[model samples]
Structures are given as structure tokens and as C-alpha cells.
Target: MLEMRKDLFADERDDNLNEVGKGSQRQDMPGHVTARTRFFDDHAFDGLLHLKVVRSPHAHARIRSIDIAAAARAPGVKRVLRGADVPVNKNTLLSLINFGKDDEPTLAVSKVCYKGEPVVAIIADTEAQAHAARKLVRVEYEPLKPVFDVEEALKPGAPVVNETYPGNYFEYHERFDHQKLRFGDVDAAFARADQVVEARYQMSPIEHAPTETNGTIAAPEHNDRYVVHSCAQGLFFSLGTTAKILNLESNRLHFIGGTVGGGFGGKVDSLTEPLAVLGAMLTGRPVRYVLDREEEMLTGSPRGAERIYVKDGVMRDGRIVARHIRSYFDAGAYTRLSSYAAIKCTAHIPGPYSIPNVSSDVYVAYTNRCPSTAMRGFGVTAVDFAIEVHMDRVAEAVNMDPMELRILNAYRDGDMKAHRRVAKNTALIECVQVAAEKAGWPLSDTARRQTSVASGGAGERGQIPATVIDQRGQIGRPDTRTGGPTQTLPAGTTRIALSKEPVMEGARDGRAAPTQVPRYEPAPRHEPARAQPPAYAPQPAPPAPSYQPASPPPAPPAPAPSPAHTQHGAVRFSSVFGTRRR
Candidate 1:
């Protein structure tokens, strides 16, 4: 059973709704309970063949030779496939969206960047035969020095991890090696601050231990098409990737996916689909490729590790004046999705607070280990943990209550965020107040009176200062000290301002009135004198809604409310047990 706190936002909700706030039975519960639900592996085929792979043993090595003759001749073996058999061997999952360069291979060719990289695929009639044949395939390698730490990989003269990104860092916009965010001058704010706090936080890589490991079954259909039953999290994404790897038209592949035991962002890489389809194409039989427990543990993509260094300048009144963050994402061996994650991490800097001066540089660095992919909240979770912990340290340094400190600096509606977007529908202050009351924590009267809606009042928080507005107006000023563009706003632009008109309600959902047309314009460019034209032409900015007022409207008159539900016979389990004997 779940509880709903309707009293919080009763006016915003429809009381006559059927299922919005009511308990309902899950639609798939019956099938799940009765074990009638079919997973990808539950389907049966007439002539199914199993697949197992020969993995590289060295973390970093150059391949000398691969001899699959013994595996091809092994009992129950139908065929063996190597890197040469793949039509297009190299791939990067985000290449479909034109995000990154091709940096990974379905099967290893001349070099193996990480241990457990698949080098050969063996197809046999039985899984046992496939396992036996996998052992017989021989591969020789020349070991190389490997670097595992993110910082170590970036050092001068460190062993290169991926030839595709030889510098060990993903190049952003073909210029800088890291995503940067700059607001006002952080150095000036730090100089005027009463107290400064700095901390370093590191997170280790975490694996998504799904109950059902990665697996796929591909069978040839009539007319050279293939139907694949896969555990991939995204059906169309896998379909397109498989087609691209096999060098076939998009119509040549069909993917069926549903009811994964668990993915947690682990199955989106299309790891097994390409090989399984290729094996079926070569042998003209249904091929099933599944990772064993050991293989899945060793080779599966995990949440990449992140290291963050946060420095904050705070006033005696508990206002955060400036925040600077430098973070590195350890994108082991290749650029899976870590490059995109770095961009997102940069946007989330100076989290949930209105600091006038903020700057961050987030890097996605490669090292010799298994490539990582998304997990639950891949970019935001680790950094949030680091920031909140850093906040507690800041509170201690200022000798203020942690809860009170959060309320003092909580972002309000209409406040300009560090990323230059105006925040709306904020409730951080109210949430902190309710949390303090529930915890029976005492707070100062000023802290208790804080509201996220109130702005421009005497000594109020979250108001964007004049300095920030001036900085925002000068869109792309080159730093005379550093001799580089500030990288705050887009290059070659002046000032940007929101229109004063209110965009009609529900504009985002396409339910606004036809008269409420949103306005947009491209940021005018001023090209510097150069030998060649600029690499990137600026695109039109998206339509931004007009700013909301600093405060919310007055509440309407109260109507007759529904009777509150009460629990009459609720008993405390701890009381019944008379508390634990200490």
C-alpha cells in the first residue's frame, strides 16, 4: 500500500479523477504471478544453435594471431566467426544520433583494449559444445602497459587507451577537451567571501547485476530478413544498430523486446544482437547468444566512476556566493555514453542553489578497463551525492544548522539557474521546512519563515544579482587573462532577453491557444578574423517561455474539504516487542 499527501497541492489537482490518486491493480501482475509471462529466452525454436565467445585475457595487448581451426572442428560445432566476419566491426552506440566516433568493436581485431573483450564467436548445436569449443580457440597477444585511473590516463606520456581518442579525453565541439560552464567571476566572489570550503569526492564503478544477463536470439526470416528476440532495453535502437553492424538495410531487421528481468541501462549497448544475427546469417540456423554469469560479471557495462572537486565561497549569512567544480568521468576504454554524461554533469553544477558566480569543467577520460554505460541516473546521482555531502561540510564550516543552511540558500521560482535557465515550480524551502518539522528539529524564526516564492524582499535569497545579469548580457566575451572565449554562452553572440508576454498555459504539451505563438531568434554572430571559416555555425535558440512573476498569486477561497482518513487500530511493532534489549 502507498500513501498520498493530497493536502499539499489540493487546489492544483482534480478531485473527481478516477485513478489519479486511487489505488489500482497492476495490469501485468496476473501474468507475472502465474509465471505465464514470456521472456526473450522462453521462446522455443526448431533448430536453435547456442553461441559462446573467446575473450581476451590481457587488459591491454596487441593481438599477434588467432587460430579458430580447432574450435571449427570441435564436436557439434556448426561454424566459427572472428572479427573478419563482421561486416562493420567498429561502432559507438551513440553514433546513430551522431554523438560520438566509432571506438568499440563487436569482436577484437588487431588489439584488445580491455580484458574480456570478445575475440571469436563459436556456434554449436548445444550450449555445452559452444562452451567447449570456446575453450579450444587460441589467441596470441603482446601485452602493453595499461592505465586504469582517470587522472593517470590524462597525465603526459601515459599509455594511450583508445586509438580513436588518442588524447584519452573526448573532444567537445572539436575544440576543448571538457564541457565548461561559466557564469560570473568566481575569483572575485571568493575574494570577498567570509568562509571558503573545498572537498574532493570519488565514486567507484558499479555494475548492474541484472537477474537475466544479456542475451539475444536471431533467426533468418523469408526474403533475407532477420527477426531478433532480444533483451535490449530499446527495440528500435537495437534494430538500427544491428542493421548498421551487419551492413544491411533497416528493413532487413526486426526486433521484439519486452519484459526484461532487469536492464538498469546495461542492455542498451546492443552487445549480443550483432553477433547472434551474423551467426544465423552464416549458418542459416537460429542462433542464441547469452552471457554466462562469469562473462556478464567481467564484461558487462557498469556505471562509470566519477571524481569531483568542489570549492564554495560562502558569506556569514549562509548564502553561497560562488561555486567551482572540476569533475572527471572515468569512461573506461571507450566512449559509450560517458561523453554525453559529462555534458549533463556540467549542466548540473552548483546544484539546486542560486550562486551568482559558478564555473565547472567536466571531462570524460578513457582508461584500460571495460567500457561503461548508463545506469539509473548515471550523470546526476553521483554528483548530487558529492554536492550534498559538500554542503554539510560547508554548514559545519559556517557553524550553522545544516537544515537551516539549505533553506537559506534554496533556489526559488523565477531564479536564474547556474546554467542560465530560469527555474519554476520550486518547492525546496517548503520541503525543508516540512522535513525539519517531521524530524522534530528546531530552527530559527528567519529560517522557518523562508519561502521559495518570495523574491526581491529584504535579504531574500535566490535573486539573480546585477553582476550575473551583466555577465549574462556579454554573451561571448573572450577572457583577456586567458586569451580564450569564456564558453559561457554560445560563441559570437551579444545579449539575450526573454519576452515580457506570458506564454499560454500548457504550451509544452501543445495545448496552448493558437493565438499564443512563442517567439524565437538566432543569436547573431560576430566572426573573428581568421584564415578559415568557423567550424560551427550557430543554430537558432529554442523558444523560451516568458518569465514568471517573483511571487505566486493569492490563494482562492477554501471550499468544503473531504473528510481526512484516519487509522484507528494502527499499532507500533516496536511497542509490541517492548523494544530491543540493549
Candidate 2:
């Protein structure tokens, strides 16, 4: 059976999308079969110049002087470009969001703070020539003590990576060292009867490690116009930032890129395309700059290093009353999105589990290693690993099953979060239940009851009892362990046990059975419907879509209410199904 159809049973009803459970054809499979795919290197043109960069060998150093004379005199070398040759030298990223500390220099002018930092560009007629000439570009440097550790860098006496930060920390207006999040009385929650569990999580900076090294080809058109071929994922962002870096109007530059080898946020950085375009303009020739494996690994932006200290005050029964998390993201040498990364880290701390009180402080610290840029999961990845490990630790402290703990604290559709927003359309409890059933974990009576109560969902299925879900909407049930509640239920009187499974079931026997919930089916239509099958399945030419005369597409859903979390860079499409185009 095809993987998609593996769940098919003897008596399963059909949905409108028959393609949902069928083997589908991959559009790109033919290209791979015929071996006719083209990458950047496949394109060739006359008067093409290969560009190589001279980079810093030291982690931290002052550029005493640079002499491009020897490289300019080298055979096959056309131009040895320095910082001064570039018309505009500045960062053009996230300015609208007002990201503080714009300190990433396009080319190192007077100082190099990280190893592999670009110092000079050597353009030549051939790749080997460019490589030979780049080695000839001599640079004098005065080595400075490198601050590689975040904790040390935050110290008063530590060597600062960039002059923008006074104490190696990214500070907002009024010199705040970190962002703060507070809800409820965290101190009082800790003071009340509870067992406090704490742990620290840390990791070093990691590189993106893409298969195809960073490469870009630039060709300048007439009248300061340019057509640039780049691997940068965000087209508008790449174009806007490149225009800013070149100090040119948006219309002057056209970015072209669709297929990428791989870019998990690492390619979001506009690193070298502007310079390549500038080089092409200066020489009036198409220019290609491709970083070899060594350069890409050394200079490419990677996810920053992070350290998180999570402290949770939980009742003996597994209810977390208070959580305090302190996180530090080390953006080595430069603040490429590290400040934003810090915010994401703090936001992800404490994870998905519900808690009464939360207080967090996330800091972005600068160090003397390669600058950390956003990679896959950038800020949230490491913190999640830390939080999960901490959750298991919390389970150990409370002597309860981790899943049981999650059941008691799972956020529900009306539960107010630590952030002011009320949770909606939440399926955390259901997801946990499904996974637990599949794994065949033992489910206690309280667990079963909680699941039943929480699943009394509102909306299309008809009103089940609004009271089934309390004002909080969490799965709270009558005491199954005791005539009342479990030991986890109360310190003085009653508190929910983290080890008990959540409340549940309109009706089910004691043994756990994982059954698929019926998918929502639209109201019956009075017209004949098209038989939709696999996209690639040869079935005597599939019929056209069956839209009835004067009928309309499904009405777009109303916009969901924004949660308490600050909307930063969220792309909300108001024209979902053309509800309102503008």
C-alpha cells in the first residue's frame, strides 16, 4: 500500500479531496530522472570575472594598514577592491523594526573582529587567478585579546567585540541589558508550598553547514541598473538590503533566485551580493563570487550559542506554580539577528506547559568568535531542548510521569496564558492523548476523565456542555486517586497531580484505544462533484473542477484574534481566499 493510504480501513468514508490518501507524483522527479537540472555554475557568459576575498586570520585585530598594490600588479587580476572603493558601507537589515546596533560592516575598514571577516576583494579573469591574487593582498593587523565566552564578555573588564555595545551586551534605549517578561506574583508562587527544581542548559555556536556553499553572480546593466543572481531565500529582503548596502534605489536592482540548495534562515543574511554587483559595475563585466567549503564554514552565519537557566517552583503533585528563566545568546563579533534571537529564546522558554507565574530575562551578549546569524530554529531550538530536559527533571522532582505532568498543565482553548492572550484552537491535550495511546502508556482514571471533559469541543459538533470546560477550559476532573484528588492535588488542601493523565471521554472503557477523530465534512452540495485522485495517477484524464453555476468558493474564515505575544514580523494575509484583497 502507498504510505499515504496506509491508514485506510475496510469501511472509511470518502472526503472531497480523494488525493489526500493516494500516492502522488513529484513534479521534480522527471528532472532528476532525465538529469537536466541546472545550478548557478551551469550559466556561462563572456568577460566573466571570478572574485576571491582576503579575510582576517585573527579573531580580533585592528587593521593597521592594507596594501592592494601587489595584488593589483598580479597577472590576470583586474581590480583589488578595498572598503573605500564601495560607495555605501552599512547594514540594511531590519531597520524598519528598529533593530538596535547596526554594526555589521560590509568590508572590514580599520579593524577585523572575527576570523574570516572579509577584508579585501580580489577580482580576476580566472578563478585560479583570483585565488592567486587574493593571497597577494597584504594586510597588517594588531591582535587584540578575544573574548570568546558570553559570561566573560558581559564582565566589565572583558574586551568588547564592537564599540556599539559598552559592556559586550546589546542594550535597548535606557541601557536595559535584557528583555523582561513577568506575569503574576512569581516570588509569592515560589514562597508558597512547593518544590523548586533548577537546571542550566548551554551550547556552543553552530554553523548552517549547507551542501552548496554560498555563491552569487552579479551583472550590472546600463544606467546603474543590475541583475543579480543570488541564493538568498527572501527575495524582497535580499533586494531591499542589497539596495541599501549599495545605496541605490530599489528599482536599480533586480534580484533573481527561486531554487536554493538549502537555506534554513542562514541565507537571509545579505552578505556578498551587493559587493559582487558593485564589482561588476566597476569593471563592467559579469562577476561570480563563490565561497569554497572553507570560507562558507568559517564566515557563514550560524545559529548563535546559548545558555539557559530554568527554575521552576512546582507543588509536590506536579503543578508548576512559577517559572523563572534566564537565557543568554552569544552573537559572536556582530549582532546579526542575535538580539532578535534573544527575544525568541525568552519567548520559547518554559515551553508549552501551562504554569501560574513566569518571569524571564533573555540577554544578547557579544563575543570574539564568528558572528552568529539566524539558522534553523535560530533562538528557539536550543531553548526547547533545554526546556524538555528541564521538564523531565521536573517530573523526576515530583516523582510523576512526564506525560501525566503535561496532561495536568496542557493549555486549552480558553485558558489564559502567562502572556495576556487566551489560548484558542489548542490541541495540545488531544495530541498528547493520541501519542500516549499509540505508545500504550498506562492511563489512570483521572487521565481518562480529563481527556473526555477536555474533548467536549464547541463549534459545529453541537453544544456538549459549556460547563464540561470550566471558565479556564483546562481538563479538570473529580478525584479518581482519592475520593477527592491525588496527592499532587494539594499542599494545604488540593492541587492537580502532574503524574495523573488529564480528565476525559464522553464514554470509553478502562483500556486505552487510539481512534482517529472524524475529519470535518462540508455540508452536502446539490451538484455533481469531480472525482479527484492522485495528481500523477493516469486515470483517462481527470475531469474539471465541479463548481456549480453561481456558486462561490468556501467563505474565508474570520481573522483569528491576535495573541498576547507581540506581533513581530508576522505576515498576516487579510486576503485569505480573497476575503478582502487589500
Candidate 3:
């Protein structure tokens, strides 16, 4: 069963000593419990008009015509805006990070590639009137076939979601459908490994389902400035990104947002605020736009669907030496935070292990659906699910304890990573120990000897809890990661082998330390003692080393090919995996 891990937040204690273990009053509880917490919708001002968007009904379609004249003349309607009305229609969420630039437009211009793409926006005297008026804006469309699968989207003849992109993939660093994290020689490591294990994982998109749905209010002020009250998770990010998209200086937009009922990275996207501010500016009056429950459920951005395939090369001891992961993140319809989500997904590949060889290709593939934004840990969360299951599978193949297998190759301080950087404050070893202890499970002496630093420490090693969810029972909550139909998928078939254990060094405290995992085997030991050469003549006679470098040795033999693998058939939407060989 999945357990609640208090140890996960051991670093979250208050500073005061008395408050350490005592139940402390939450600062926001009183206001929240009393229904006094102020959300954006709670703020009312005179002449507040409601804005409603006319969304496309077809998944993919070209607009033959958008007749907004009727909506403009509808009852209580002040104005209606379309794609052409947006001063700066194009936007790129990751331009600062030098990623694929300007893929999403503020409104559907020539075509609507997704079902919910905005066609016309109606501003009216009341929320009811705005909704009624939006219905009057008729849009004509020629429906185009859309590709939903990540792999299918990359196929040569597949329907392109965005015609400007040249393909259904986000291009990065002059390449399409790829972000690579290359470290050591994976091919060589695989050759040395005794066995290879592979598995594919898929996760469907899940809605955040926060207590408060997204809403915003924008008010116009003197000197063409605007003030926005939103529930965006990060104020600075929303302020700057929205300001840039509006073609206005950041100083012109005064953003007031300190209360978010709950947002696990869901509200980070500057989706509603930009349009809300634009409405206030165009109408020269306050505009309030709030997503009712139905709109939020159907149109709000959810976690991207993920599909991942992982292949690992390891010795008999469950010590991983090489890994190859390929992931496709379905950045549906438009690229929002999905590019960064794909980045994070790839970054978490070969999770927390110190492997010697790694190869990862993560792609954020565009498809026809609502644009995905961030969800709690987004990319990392999905990859973590894949890799952990992958690790357990590897352990089972080698007939070793899963926890012991983790401790065997768990990263230690100073361990080099797939990104070519050395790690610090490593805690995987300590993590497994604490987890086993809390579950009242006893560990072998060898397992207990492993340390995070690989050095002696007095008290418990730093907390990095490893929560295990038994495969049988249902894991509650809407989380797709920890519990879902697709997460527990098996590889179906496989072959594995293991090499003999290597010699280990003794700990400084006289205990046996965990053995080092060497990529190359040691040379044979010399058998006969060297004949006692004449005392003075022996050393001097050794020729001076050649000035030129010696030629490199012949390479080792290659490993036999393993069964081919494919990612699990599907996800609702994105996916990537990373590899690092220790």
C-alpha cells in the first residue's frame, strides 16, 4: 500500500523549539474556515463587465469566416474581439530559455487547431449576457483530421497540427523531436553488462481539480496602465510573461495576487490574465473573467499525457551500467509549459542513479487538444513512476531484494551524473534505510553498511524517504503517477545476466564499504616475483618513457542484440526519460 511519508518533509519544521513537534495553527486557516479568504471573484467594483470567449468546436479546422457583427450588436454587448484584435497575438512561453519560439497565438487566427481555441470574445454588462452574446458569434469551419498519438504525429504522412512548425514536433537546437542528455559511452557499457532489461510506461492526463478554479479581474487606470488581480501561482512570472505578451512594459501592469486557494503549478501559465487585461484596455472599463466549473473541467490545462520506454544494462547484482530512454511528451494543440515539462521529464531519467552510460531523447510533440501547463512536478513525476517500476523489474530479474538493489547503485557524494556533473549531499542510501526502518522491515548487514556519503556518520543519514505502494491494493487520490491502469504495465518478456562481484575497499572506521562498480575489468596479477636485479643497475636501466603517446588498445567485443522495445501504446497527452552510467 502507498504510505503517507512524514519523513518526506522533515526539513519543514518551524524554528521555535516548542513548536517542533507540537501542532501549530496554520496562519490561513482562520480566514479560510470562516469563508473570509478573498479570491479574485470576491472583489467587486462598479461597471464590472464579464468577458466570455467563443471556443472552437472542432478538434482541427480552418476558419472560413468568423461573423462577430451579430455578437457586437447582441443585447448588453459592448464589444467583441477576435484574433485580429490582439496587438501581439503570437507568444512563446520558453523564449527566455531559448526553446521553440512563438507557437501559441492569443486567439485562433486563420485556423483553430484544437477544439477549445478561442474564436471570438464577448464583453457585456453581465456574466449571463456575455455568455448569451458569445453564442451569437458564428464561426464557419472546414474540419481537418488531427493526430493524437505522439509517435503517429512524427510519422511522415501524419496531419500537422501547426502548419508553421513544418511538422508535428517542437524543434530544439536545430533538431526536431529530440532533447539529448549524453554522458558516458552507452554502447561500451552495454557490451560489458551481463543482461539488459526493458519496459514501457504510459500515463493519461489528470486535471489539477483545485478548490478554486482560475479567475481574473483587470481594471484600467490613467496613463494607459492596468491593474490585474489574478490567482496565478507565481506573481512575477505571470506579470512579466503577460506584460511582454501584451506589448506593454512590466511597470504598466500592477498585479495583485497573494491568495491562491490551491495551485500545484497549475496556475503558473499566464492564460486568462493577458486577455482579461486586454479586455479592460479595449473597453476602457473593468473586465472580470471567471471560469465556471464546467469551463474549468473541459478547457483548463491539465498535466500532459506521457509515454516513456526505458532499457537498462546491468550485471547480475542489479547494478545498472547503461540505460537508454526515449520519451515523447504530447504537448497538445499548443506549446505552453509543456516544453519545460519535457525538459524536466528528460532531466529525471536514470533517476538519482550513478550509472556510467546514458542516452535520452525527450520530445514535446504537438497534438490537437487543450495546451498543457505545469502540474505538481509535471515531467519528473511521470518519469519517476517509470524508472522506479523499471528498477523493481531489474531487481526481480536478478533475484535480489528491490531495496538492496537500490542501495547497490544508489548515488553517493561525488558521484558523476549523466549531465557530466558530480553530485553532492547524496541521500538515496539513507533514504532506503529510513524507509525500511519505518516499515519495520529488517535489512541485511551489507545494506546497513551503505551510506549516503560513503563515509561514517553517527546519527541517521539525512532523510530522503522511499515510499512503497504495494501493487495489489488501490492507491486513492486522482494521481495518475502513484496509481493508474497504465502505470503497472509489464515488459512481457526479457533476458538477463550478471557478472561476479568485484573487490571492495575497507571503510575508514574498519567496516566493509560497498564495492565500487568499475566499467572495465582489472588486469591479471603478475605471477612470479621479479628476479633481484643488481641493486644499482636495475632502476637506471629502465628506458626513458617515449615522448609520443602510446597507441590506444583494441576495443572490447559487442553485446548480442536484445529484444526490441516500444513505448506503451498511448497517453492522453507528453513523455521523456534520461540515462546515466556510473
Clashes of each: 0, 16, 17
Best by TM-score: 1
Candidate 2, residues 1-582, lDDT tens digits: the string is: 534433323233455566676678988778667866555555677889998899999998888999999999999998888888766564525442334535667888978889999999999999999999888888999998888888788654677577655456665321245665555556667889479888999987788888877778888777768888888877777776666566566777877875566777778787768778888888999999888888888889888989889998999988888888888888888877787777677656557766666777777888888888888877889888888888889989999998888877766555545544445556566667767887999767686556423532233112211110011101111112013211121111211111111122212221322121111122236323423212122222212111123232322222332332212111121122121222
lDDT of each: 0.74, 0.66, 0.68
Candidate that would win on lDDT:
1
Candidate 3's residue-wise lDDT over 1-582, tens digit each?
Answer: 545355543564444466555677999889999999887777878899899888889988878998988888989998898888877687666542333456677788778878877778889999889989988888889888877888787665677676545456664432124565555556667789989888999989888877788879999977768889998988877886676556667778889987997777678877688889989988889998887777777778889998999989999878798898889888888888887787677667779887766767787787887778889889899988989999999999898889999998787776655554466667898889989988988889999988776642212112211111111111111122123222111212111112112232233121332122221224223312222212112111122111112222211212321423111111101231233232
Please give, for residues 163-231, the per-residue lDDT of candidate 1 as tens digits: 766667775432246766667768779999998899999999998989999999999989878889999
Predictions: Cα RMSD each:
14.5, 19.6, 19.4
What does candidate 2 score on TM? 0.74
Off by over 4 Å in 1: 9-17, 456-582
Once superposed on the true structure, which residue ranges of model 3 sit more than 4 Å away at CA?
Answer: 1-27, 96-98, 455-582
TM-score of every candidate relative to the true structure: 0.80, 0.74, 0.74
lDDT score of model 3?
0.68
The residue pairs found clashing in candidate 1 are none
Compare candidates 1 and 3 on TM-score and give the better one: 1
